[model samples]
Target: MADLALQFGGDLAIGPTGDLLLSEGTTLTQQRVLRRLLTNPLDYIWQLNYGAGLGKYVGQPGAPAAIAGMARTQILLEAAVVASPAPIVGVMAQTDGTVNLSLSYTDAAAGETSALTFSL
Candidate 1:
């Protein structure tokens, strides 16, 4: 959610006349989007969280021991996904149930493109 978090913040826009704006619907340039994508600091944290032990919480508690926690996490994670407003910017997941990952975007440059893919 890090890059997605920032990308949500990246909310760059171009004014009808031309200028840089932010998520508030100002105006911005193509360069600003790229800048956000390249420099946003969250990429590091995003990678770690997505690639590591995200499974512990999957089990969570006594909702039901029989209920597969990993499966549950995957389901909720996926749901938080489609329900998200911003286009997904990036993702990382481990093959084992040990890790799962997702990204949600809040801000998106007009014409900007994004996709979400998962493995595990």
Candidate 2:
């Protein structure tokens, strides 16, 4: 089954037909991965530990290694990512207080590699 398509920041996506879009394949996997990383833990009532909560690090001390490790672990938990070749996570803390996150992983369902870059 496909999920309602969502933009990077959780906005609803519109399809060419003037209706809500649905996501599948690589796009779906990327969306799910982003959601997992951005959502705060315990925010989702049913699954208290479902998220990496990357936002929690904002305005706090810089810990690129720790953040990257956390992201890598979270990415591997997704079913779409292959477990053998671990995801490569890069976290860069900018002078302006924002953090850049980059990752590359193999998508199990699509049998192809994918990369995502975003900020926190």
Candidate 3:
């Protein structure tokens, strides 16, 4: 694959029509899942692999905590990965099996798992 960048530019939004608005960037190129979006304008949140971030987690504003400031979790059920940005593409699965997708988050000592169950 060619070296490229995928930008997710936007606020913490699940768009008026349900589409998510993340940030714009150069590192998020040709990647498909298994990543995180940390430290938006939010507080009191915790997340695990492959989800949108809203706390003190990654990168630097030139601060170690200001990477891609905002993003939305691409839960298989929340929304489908129709298409990726320019120079970026997702790795399509090559089998028919249980696509077990799970997401965990904690806030104020309380935690929950948001699952996006689906079939192949």
lDDT of 3 by residue, 9-59 (tens): 423446466656333321222122323332233332563234444233322
Give candidate 2's whole-model lDDT.
Answer: 0.89
Q: Alpha carbon lDDT of residue 48, candidate 2?
A: 98
- The TM-scores, one per candidate, come to 0.20, 0.92, 0.18
Q: For model 2, how does the per-residue alpha-carbon lDDT over 1-104 read when each residue is reduced to its tens digit?
A: 69899965668979999999999999999999999999899988999999999888877765677789889999999999998788889889998988999999
Instruction: Please give the TM-score that candidate 2 achieves against the real structure.
Output: 0.92
lDDT, candidate 1, equals 0.32
Return the clash pairs for model 2, or none.
Answer: none
Model 3 CA deviation exceeding 4 Å by range = 1-48, 57-60, 63-66, 69-79, 86-120
How does each model score on lDDT?
0.32, 0.89, 0.28
Candidate 3, residue 35: lDDT: 35
Instruction: Write down the TM-score for model 3.
Output: 0.18
Top candidate, metric lDDT: 2
Cα misplacement distance, residue 89 of candidate 1 (Å): 11
- Write out the backbone clash pairs for model 1: 8-107, 13-27, 13-28, 14-28, 15-27, 20-27, 20-28, 21-27, 21-28
